[model samples]
Target: MSDITVTTEDGKTSVCSPYDTTFVSKAKTIGGRWNGPAKAWQFDARDENRVRDLLREVYGTDGSPTDDSDLVTVRVRLADHEVSYRDGADAKFAGRRIATRPGRDSDVRLAANVVLIAGKLPSTGGSMRYPQINAGDDVIVEVRDIPRATLSLEREGSYEIVGETRGEVDVDALLTEREQLLARLAEIDALLPEPEGTETTTQEAAKALGVSVRTVQRWAATGKVEARKNDQGRWIITITI
Candidate 1:
């Protein structure tokens, strides 16, 4: 867990960091774009030095040393969604272009021959979601080495990698994790007995608070707000508003 990670792959360098407006502005100035699929800002390989300098200026250091030992390079052919790369007389390309009204059927396919020859195809044992692509923008793909546990922890609002819990670590990541833990703990701590607002069911409380019924249920379970289950198996929430 580091404030910033610099990864170089496929002739491109990707820099991942926690969200910061200042860092984002500087990253854009150096030809960096948010690669949604990779969850990182990407730059051309030639800008590696500039990227490092930018990281230093913004974060006081290049936060994490990237390990490319697990990475495999693969070529990706990119073209504008408006242009056709196939033969000029290919009717399918023309038909697709007409169907999209201006866009092309530019599917990002992995080179199967190269994958088989290199024998570097990643294992499919982990949970991987399909990537989302912008319909009209230029197709850009970046592959990074992120662990499966990292994704799982992210869902529960934790970002630390598995088994790296001790020693000198990124201050920012620690601070962020601490904040999240404190917030959840505060929610749970609210379970203490108090008598103030009128008692209502989860649905009534949700409507009064302008939140969803499920949110009220979660609040009851977490003590985020005050609530308890009555004998009838319904949540009895105490809401002032």
Candidate 2:
């Protein structure tokens, strides 16, 4: 028998455990908020993995709470595809099952009851990665932890699941990558030895210089105006007057 109990209420994972300094410390470190009313530590359901790990550490095994009471059921509207979750699929990432059974209906609603994890992984560049869905209608996705999850809709094409699986963002990795990029950028900027001038976008420069955007582009291309592309490959012009 496990000394800890894990349950879900109001979209939050509630963990009731015996008073252990180690468990309390680790739980607080993992952002578990104390709930006075329930006498349990409440956490974002997406952090279920971390909570389970803690349980495994303090207790010899993951908490014995296997009741559906611990599961959080959320409704997701899928367009052009139906999603079905297999029992015990949430045990491991590789074991996750998102079976899509498409039908004649334009939209299908599925209740993701046993889903503890959701959302796309972060990109290599440390920016957010938005999973593309079918663009017929706004598809509401279930992001387990946070209140909001960003997803994009591709126009005119059906969305393919491919080998993609939902996972939480590695915030530490993203922050470290961002810092390294910024430092490298600073070094590159220093090496360029270019004088900092009034930096503005092509559109803004065009409006300021009272010229057409095409004229601005022409000027930039011919070196008639000092302009360069930013990280996003957008034209940034150093304009006078």
lDDT of each: 0.49, 0.50
Tens digits of per-residue lDDT, candidate 2, 4-114, equal 567654668889865545677889998998889989999997677689787666543444422211322232433333221321111111111122222222222222322
lDDT tens string, model 1, 105-152? 333233212111212222221112322122222322222233222232
Candidate 1 lowest-lDDT run of ten: 89-98
Clashes per model (N, Cα, C within 3 A)? 0, 0
Q: Flag regions of model 2 displaced more than 4 Å.
A: 65-241
Which model scores highest in lDDT?
Answer: 2
Model 2 local distance difference test score: 0.50
Shift of residue 173 alpha carbon in model 1, Å: 19
Instruction: Compute the lDDT of residue 175 as modeled in candidate 1.
Output: 74
For model 2 the local lDDT of residue 123 reads 21
lDDT of 1: 0.49
